[model samples]
Target: MTTFYSHLKRSALIILMLNSFCAFLQKAHEITYVVGCFENGTTETLLEFDSDEVFYVDFEKGEVEYTGPYMPGFDPSQLFQDLQIYKNALRNSKACKAIVAYGTIMEKQPSEEKDPPESILYTAEEVDKGVENSLICFVNHFYPPLIKVTWTKNGQPVSEGVSLSRYYPNQDQTFHQFSTLTFTPTETDIYSCTVEHMALDRPQTRIWEPDFHHQHFELDVFCSVGLILGLLGIVAGTFLIVKTL
Candidate 1:
């Protein structure tokens, strides 16, 4: 499925400043209003404070949802006095539908360009043998916004503790997504994440494995050096005491 969006934004700012010889303080806050219409006949209206979502209109349920904490001294009722925001969103959706229909009839649809995705696989924390950790698969910069992600351990499919996130839009109009797997690190286990999308001729895979042997070797060398130094220090102390006596 493909979706096109018509976006509109409104902003209000509040600034306060206090200046004196001893101290100076300034505080500035902004409220953003956004309305959008999707090609699938869905509409979204949002109110954000400092880029954090505070309120959104749920057209399907015919209600306004409070998505974030209440802001002191800000009254949401004022914005919905006559439900004008909802009405505007409905009108915008209708206009978008009409435009899409006209474009279809005229054979003037948007360009069908495909952008391939880039993916990376990494562990959430330092990998240690027998330690529970999470593997993250990040995929970005893909167009059309549909992709499949799967995980495998030691060449076998892994289903438990796998999760996929919703698509997030990028500034270039492409999209990004994330998938995660929960697994325990082992010296002999290998993990892989595979991503498949329409833009790719074949699926892409990333692999990860633990470096337990390397880490253990480094630790052993460190401990051996420390033991040698400790023994030399004891011998030198004994020699000093006997000569003084």
Candidate 2:
């Protein structure tokens, strides 16, 4: 899990490909090696290996420091040497230049050409009165991760007991995210989830009522009883026909 988290974090940080033109002309190429520290499940880039200056994030003090970048199981010298080799290669290779050009082209691509997101609002289980419930609004198949989810109860905005999850990547280069609203439902309370994105001209709203769940439960029970009576009638008719034969 730690390895996976580190890979994901590095993937997010390594968005900009370091392809410096005129590497010899500049004192340092645009290459930054980051060494992130993880404790429990939280991780942050604590060490930044730069050619000019090195720094780390001091989350506890709420400030970043440049005094000394050090970690227990890391050697900055080897990292610097490896980066230097790559920077030297970047100076020589025509393929590297082509890659840099391609990356530039991709960066300038228009957002309008990308597909919009699809969102669905639902709950983990049936919402019942006086029971703790989790109302989830799922937004998926989105190209960009810009989205807003709001929950409302009785036509009023609800902010408490709400949490938004991180953006999870999909296989097709899209993203998925979820927002949860935890509350104890009541008989007359009406809940709604609204989603706002660039794809929609107006906010998309989905409403939920506790009474509907109760109605569905009652309908299911009624259907089950009707099915049982029909089966009994069929059995009795078959027995009577056998006796007559």
Candidate 3:
């Protein structure tokens, strides 16, 4: 009777331990994630996947960042849907850091979404049809970094007789992108700026001055600018001369 009673007690304890272990496994399989946007910017964390490759990044890193798994296959997209909760997750999650090592687990990459570089349209001080060599101005409203400014004439890239200035940020938090192209701009010439970025919808601008002002306002503007420059030069030269004396 004592031996039989011992056997019964051991059987009950084994069953209880098995049930508890199953409950713990179920809880571990639950999925959880977090998304945060600090002062630097916004980002998402995809937790506990089979792979550990960091796929996406902010694209302002001075290199064109085009990465990620865009196509959604049945197995990959479905399995990944369980954990990824980014609104633009699949689209902006293309970081190129995936590789197979020791194991063949699939992975996802991170992508950056920067404000698209604005289109540049040439705006002149004049507003008429025919005039001689008017001052050509390129005006574009940008959002900030991750952009390169270049000028093209007649659809060909050119760098001669051109000038570029640092971006000016407005009080309202908009970026002002400026580049100047100097040439004998003719009606047939198409002066434009090409902006390069990671997005397929990058920047290719064609400023149509089809019938803009051509009045010779250079003298007035030139005189004003010249006077200021002259005065500055005189002041600087005077300071040097006085110091030498």
Candidates in order, TM-scores: namely 0.60, 0.50, 0.34
Can you write out model 1's per-residue Cα lDDT over 69-97, one digit (the tens) per residue?
A: 57787766665668676676667556656
- Which candidate number has the best TM-score? 1
- The TM-score of candidate 2 is 0.50
Q: Number of clashes in every candidate structure?
A: 0, 0, 12
Better of 1 and 3 by TM-score: 1
Q: Give the residue spans of candidate 2 off by over 4 A.
A: 1-112, 212-245
lDDT of 2: 0.59
Q: Pick the candidate with the highest lDDT.
A: 1
Tens-digit lDDT string for candidate 2 (158-236): 9999999755445354567899999887888888989887667788888877776667889899999999999999999
- Model 1 scores a C-alpha lDDT of 0.70
Distance from true location, Cα of 102 in model 3, Å: 31
lDDT of 3 by residue, 140-239 (tens): 4443333576777777888887676544333232345566665564556666666664442655655554433333465568889999999999999999
| Residue 201, candidate 2: alpha-carbon lDDT | 74
RMSD, model 2, all Cα superposed? 14.6
Clashing pairs in 1: none
